[model samples]
Target: MPTHLIIHGRVQGVFYRDWTVSTARRLGVSGWVRNLPDGTVEAHLEGSPDAVEAMIGKMRDGPPAARVERIERSEAKAQGAEGFKRR
Candidate 1:
């Protein structure tokens, strides 16, 4: 499954991107994550259904310092992304 996610709350300075990258890679997911200008974190995750769902669950908590309020999820087209990255 390929998904687009927008995470809200204290995610910008909390190493969320780094954590997402590592976690996604570990899960055999491929995509990119970036901090949006609107104080949100946006990511494109593409992999197996289990991996994508697991990633979304992890994003809910984020890192130790992160305070995730909510996540907006939607369907996304597969990009055949090579590796997870911070964009």
Candidate 2:
């Protein structure tokens, strides 16, 4: 199943999005992550269930500089993501 996540907290300007993209690509996951105007980071990932879960876990703990507060996730339809992107 595909997974969609909306992460909130101090997750911007600290290389959060860039780190996420790198991690996702390394995991061979297809999706995109972007910075929201509300200071939150939203990402959509599609791959093996286990891989997606692992990515979510990493997102919760992000990079050393990231202070993730909460991450909301749910199942979503895959749109055939081209690659991990920033926006």
Candidate 3:
């Protein structure tokens, strides 16, 4: 199953999107992360349950400069994400 995560707070302009792309790649997760106009970071990650969870866990702490405040997670239907990207 795939998972979608919407992270809020201090997530933009801090390399969060870039870090998410690299981190997800390292964890072998497929999906994308983007910066919302409202200053939130949204991501869609697909992989094994464990891998997805790992990615989410890291997102909660983002880069050392990031201060993640809230993470909303929900199960998502697989969308066949080809690779990790930042947007």
Query: CA lDDT, every prediction?
Result: 0.94, 0.89, 0.90
RMSD of each: 0.6, 0.9, 0.8
- Return the number of clashes found in candidate 2: 0
Clashes of each: 0, 0, 0
Indicate which candidate wins on TM-score. 1
lDDT of 3 by residue, 1-87 (tens): 698888998988899999999999999999998888888888999998899989888889999999998999888888899889887
Across residues 1-87, which tens digit of lDDT does each residue of candidate 1 receive? 889999999999888999999999999899999989999999999988999899899889989999999999999999999999999
The candidate scoring highest on lDDT is 1
Query: Per-residue lDDT tens digits of candidate 2, residues 4-78?
Result: 888988889899999999999998888999988889988989888888888898999999899999998888999
Report the Cα lDDT for residue 52, model 2: 85
Superposed model 3: Cα runs more than 4 Å off: none
